[model samples]
Target: MKAILKQHEEHKRELEQLNDHWENSARYLEYTKQELEERLYHAEESAILIKEELDEISIQKEIEIQRLKDEIKDLRQEISFLSSSQVNNHRVKELEDALNKAMREQMEFKEKLRIAKEQSEGGNGEVTEVTTTVRVIVKVRPFLDSDPAGPQCLMCNDTEVQIESKKVGSAKCFMFEKVIGPDDSIDELFMDLESNIVHAANGGNSCILAYGQTGSGKTYTMNGVISRSLNKLKQRFDCESVMISLQIIEIYNEQVKNLLTNDPLSRDWKDILNLSEIQLGNNWVSKAQDLIKKSCHKRQTKSTDSN
Candidate 1:
């Protein structure tokens, strides 16, 4: 019995040790679980922080990319604008060159035509006498109040006129039979033409034609010439022996009309009457002057760009 009791006590002690060991093991397990849970929580927080940092970095990168794109777009636009400007400048240069070439060609052609005409005239089978049949006179008008203000491009002397070229940067000279400057008087011009044209009218058909741009004093000069010429004719010829006839006509818009006709509006052939001779007298001269004035009033006039 004693042995059996001792064995039983030993068994009971073994069971208590086992129970204590189990309790210690369970406590250790609980502590380990708590530590593991805390570590997992910390890891989760770190992951969230990393995600936020990544998002911020991505946003900054996107902003930088957008800024670069805008800069590139602006650069392209500037390049395009510069290219267009260059093209426009090149086109304008080409047009100017073409215009200059055309002007040069036209001048050359005109010179050739003049030479050809002279050659043809010389070759004609006739007694070719060097006579001043045609005379070209250049008249430079004085500046008027209505004219635009700028540097004078034309320079003139007694027999030569020079024009400064803007493109060539040189002066081009032209020779004429007479070059009437702004300072030259109407009397001088009349004196120049009187011996050649007015005196020749007595023997042959002679005409004094005034050709010029609008507002170049053509009418004023012609009126003065006519008055002077009539007085000169009266002085040269005896009134009884010489018979003077007057006919006045006007050409406007490519149509001819007799200014001295009974009907001013009539364009018929009958309206042009045959010129009759009358004794050259003061009465006839006064009538002629009056007729000229009437004809001048009937002339067609319009404003031009040059005027």
Candidate 2:
């Protein structure tokens, strides 16, 4: 009976021990489950935060895209306005050109009538020959930056020029009233021509003509001559007693255009001149220079083979 009871006690203790072990395992599994739940909760919160950030970023991108679209629309409108303005400006320029042409034609007609009336008054159909001394001045232009490198072909002296001839193997000499070298100054040229040309104009009609190749400094020389001649005349004549009248005309493409009337920006030319007298002073000279500049600006130019 004691052995049976001891065996029963041993079985009971083993059952107690198993129960204790099972309880400990269950407690540990419960702790692990809690930890997993906490982790899952924190992950869900992070996902929500990230989704919110993405939504904010998307909104900002939309705003930026709309702003850019607005700017592009404004720029397109501005370009359209500028295009219309350019067209209007072109049409205005065409009208101004036409007005200038009409005025030039009217002036030319009046000049022709005046000339015809003078011829009628003279009444002598026979033309009178007036002997006037003719002087020819030759000027050699200096080498420019655009000029090609080559050997000198012409040697110039005070009153003559010698050109080298490769075919003849000789230098051909030509005599002129005055031969101006490339090194000569505009003042030197003006001085040479003044005594014969400018002074003679006071007594009778005198003409100074410039003819040359495209880039041979004809316009430059003529401008200098005009300025110097005006100053010399101002000094020679009494401003109070003698009045000087000036007229400038340009011929281009077989058409004669009055430069004084062509420039729209300049003041009325009649204000500078009167029927009975012309105002001559520093003010007049300044006005004249300004008018000349405006008129020259209106003169058309085209590129040539030599230039």
Candidate 3:
């Protein structure tokens, strides 16, 4: 039947989207790994330079200690030879004081080198990496064909987004990590986010929520992102051993309904008391889109506010 083929086509599209998302994620992770490696390399080089400077200072200290020891030894020999002829007590005392001062200076220099070495070798001679914070980004999708193309309220720059109010004659600006314009592709949107997705795929749980007012392109944007994430997971795991599950949930008027259910006519909230018990197993992909269509149809015609 035509319906069966259409359902099959939808599944294929879902799989394709998943594959693309995952591929993008893998690429992003590889790029991040390279960046970290580069940063570590530079840190190591800097550590080496610091060690070299400290070693130079240590070498200078050794040379000075040797010079001072040699001078003290010569002075001692001279004092000993003069002792038999009644050398001046004041001169002998001054020479002894100078020798003691040199020894003290040598010990102070060695102590400085010890402290310097301890600091330079904090992480097995590797400098600790700096931690980075998560950044929020905002993106605006392109206007649809039916929408008017003219000056809009939204404004975006590299680091912020501004929305102007015509009635209030004022603008509100929100700071973000990055801002994507309407002309940007979904790939551009996920360019920086793929690393996080890849991380999540490797047993790390991640939640991506698409939230906005009605008809704000939230579904469109999230669909693209979710598809990409699934694609990346495919690459990381074996196809034979891995199983992917999809469940679409619809909640209306404070009542929850599984959009991937068998009975498309199960829209009455009174029929189900506890929404928490609704569970669609891993095999819901077949009727997911069709059930969503039926749910939408019921919502538009029925008055959910009434009994």
TM-scores for all candidates?
Answer: 0.51, 0.48, 0.45
Better of 1 and 3 by lDDT: 1
Candidate 1, residues 134-237, lDDT tens digits: the string is 88877666666586643277777669988886776898999999886654456556645765554364476567899977887899989998988777766666
Per-residue alpha-carbon lDDT of model 2 for 1-307, expressed as tens digits? 9999999999999999999999999999999999999999998888667656655654554455344334433443454465667766665555555544543443344334334433444423222222447778998887665876422777777689887867778989999988877645576577556654444545767778898989999989988997887677666665555555556666566555556664332233353333313343445555667777777777868998898
Which of 1 and 3 is the better model by TM-score?
A: 1
Give lDDT: candidate 3, residue 168. Answer: 62
Candidate 2, run of 10 with poorest lDDT: 121-130
Backbone clashes in model 3, listed as residue pairs: 18-231, 19-231, 21-228, 22-228, 22-231, 22-232
Q: Give model 1's TM-score versus the native structure.
A: 0.51
By lDDT, the better pick of 2 and 3 is 2
Give per-candidate clash totals.
0, 0, 6
The lDDT-based order of candidates, best leading, equals 1, 2, 3
Using TM-score as the measure, the top candidate is 1
Regions of model 3 farther than 4 Å from truth = 1-43, 46-135, 144-149, 264-307
Stretches of candidate 2 exceeding 4 Å from the true structure: 1-132, 149-151, 165-170, 197-201, 263-283
